[model samples]
Every structure is written in C-alpha cells, then in structure tokens.
Target: MQARYYTLNEARAALPVVKALMSQVQEARSEILRLRPEIWPVLQKAAHNGGNAAAGSVYSQFDKLETGVKGILKMGILVKDIDMGLIDFLSIRNGREVYLCWKHGEEDLSFWHDVNAGFGGRQPIDPEDF
Candidate 1:
C-alpha cells in the first residue's frame, strides 16, 4: 500500500483520536509490565510455541496492545515507542518528507524532525513551516 501522508491540518484533525488510541496502548502496556512476573513463565512457554490457559490475563493485555497499535498503523501513523507513547505522522516540509513528532501527554503537536532524525532530533515546529 502507498504510504499515507498527512497535511498539517489533517494531522491535527486526527490528534484527538490518536490521543485516545495512545492512552489505550499505554494502559495495556503498563498492565503487561505489571503482570510480567506472573506471566514470565507463560511467556517463556509461548516463545517455545506452547500455550497456557493460566495466562489468560496476560494474553488479554497482549490482545489489547496489538489492537491499539494496529489501529494507529491502520491510520498511517508510525508508532515509534509504545513505552514512551512516541508517534510520527508523515508530512511534507520544504517539499521533502519529514515526521511530525508527538509524545504522550503533549496537548498539541508542535515538533517535527527530518525523516532520518528520529526522536532525538525533533525540533519545534515553526508556525510558518507547517
């Protein structure tokens, strides 16, 4: 499938839904981490292609995480770090593709980075740039 790129307005328009989805992703991830000790054995078994009915809760959290991440990807947003709730919307800047960077808890999307820059290279968006 061709990659979906968002205009600045379009990306902003999608922010509310993105925030909700990220909340789900983060909540599921936190629960998964919290259950790590209890589910470690089940996880190890599953790595060996075995299933354990005893780890149903862990499995349910995995389902929720997968659903949330997939939901975001289906909208063409790149989820960079689920733990940190980092995401990027592909957008054009100066006629080149760049990422509009956003993280969980941010009320607005106000940063951008070159395609190769990653999160470390994020820069505040200039109002005139977008």
Candidate 2:
C-alpha cells in the first residue's frame, strides 16, 4: 500500500479520531495480556483432558484485540507501542519522511523525529516545520 503522508495540520486534525481508536486498541491489548496466563493453562488442560470453558472467552478476546489493532493499522497509523499508546503518522519534513509522534494522554501532536530516529530522538515540533 502507498504510504499516506500527513501535513502537521492534517495530523492534528486527525487526532481526535486517532485518539479514540488508540484508546480501544489499548484496552483490547490490556485484556489480551491479562488473559494470556490463564489462556495457556486452559489450553494445556484441554489438550490433556477435555475442552476448556474459559478457552472460548480467551480466544474471543484475542480476536477482538487483533481486529482492533488491524483497524488502526488500516488507517496508516503505526502503532509503535500499544502498552505505551505511542503512535506515529508518516509525514514529510524537509522533503524526507519523518514521524509525527504522539503518546497517550498528550493534548496534541507536538513532537516529531526522523524516520531512523525512534521516540528517543523526538524533538518538539517547530511552528515553521508545519
């Protein structure tokens, strides 16, 4: 798929929708992690003995989590870290690809970094950069 490039303003404008989807992704991710431990044991028991009643619920959670994440990815937003709620929008800066970075709970997209530079290299977005 072709990469979608967002201008700073475009990225900002998309934030509300992105934020809502990210929240759903985070919740689904958390549910998967919480159910992970129980799921394995349930699977193991079912393999040796009989069907596990809880297994169905665990699989359902996994399906929902996968669907939620896929929905976000389909929007061209890279979900860097679901637990941390870090997402990046592909953008052009100085004629090169860069990431417009936002973390969970941030009021706006105020930082960006070179494509090669991860979150550790985030720099405050300069007004002129827009």
Candidate 3:
C-alpha cells in the first residue's frame, strides 16, 4: 500500500479509531488463543473431512483482525513494536516523510526516512524544511 503522511492533528484525530481497532486486535488475539487448543482437533478433522472450511473460517477471522491492525498502523498511529519509538506528526516532502519522534528516548521528531523505510533507516528531519 502507498504511504500517506499525516500531520500531528491528523494523526491525533485517528486516535479514537486506532484505539478501538487496537482493542479489537487484542480481543481477537485472546479469542484465537482461547480457541487454539479446543479447535485444533476440530480444525484438523474439518481439514481432512472436506476443504478445511472450519479452519479456513478461523484463519480468515484472524487475517481480518491482523489486517485491521496494520491498517491503523499504516495511518501513522505508531503502536506496533513500542520499543521502537514514539512518532507524533508525519510529514511528506520531496517524496519522503518524517515521523516526529515523541518517545522516552528521543527528544524530537528529528528522525525520518522514506515511506517504505523502517526506523533503522531514519535520517534527521530538518526543522527548517517543513
């Protein structure tokens, strides 16, 4: 998916939605964990019985939940891998965007990188450049 840059306000605007989606992910994770043991045998039997319809349903639900989480993260609400860093505002300029760092270890949003790049590839965001 293409990357979309969001200002501090825009990213913040998504907080409620992101939080809700995160909650859903957590719930789905819990459901999957709870069902694993009981459903494994059933899933195995279903897989062997027909075309794995039962197992496919469970997997599809898991995929949907995972996709939902990624969708929120794609919007710039940095929640995945909290150990990475906190990112506030996101700005795109000259084909790249910078994430305003706002975490315990970073002082500012001075770090940045290409849309497809990860934290390790972040370059310093020049304040004067917008």
Candidate closest to the true structure, highest TM-score: 1
**TM-score list, all predictions:** 0.89, 0.84, 0.51
CA RMSD, predictions in order: 2.3, 2.4, 6.4
Q: What residue runs in model 2 are displaced by over 4 Å at the alpha carbon?
A: 47-53
Instruction: Looking at model 2, report the run of 10 residues with the lowest lDDT sum.
Output: 45-54
Q: Between candidates 1 and 3, which one is better according to lDDT?
A: 1
Across 25-85, the per-residue lDDT of candidate 3 in tens digits comes to 6666666776687669987666556535546656866986677667666775555343332
Q: Is 1 or 2 the stronger prediction by lDDT?
A: 1
When 1 and 2 are scored with TM-score, the better candidate is 1
Candidate 3 has its poorest 10 consecutive residues by lDDT at: 80-89
lDDT tens digits by residue: candidate 1, 7-88: 8889899999999999999998998888888779877867647556546777888898998888889899999999899999
Q: What C-alpha lDDT does candidate 2 achieve relative to the native structure?
A: 0.82
- Off-target runs (Cα >4 Å) in candidate 3 are 48-67, 70-96, 100-130
lDDT of each: 0.88, 0.82, 0.57
Q: How many collisions per candidate?
A: 0, 0, 3
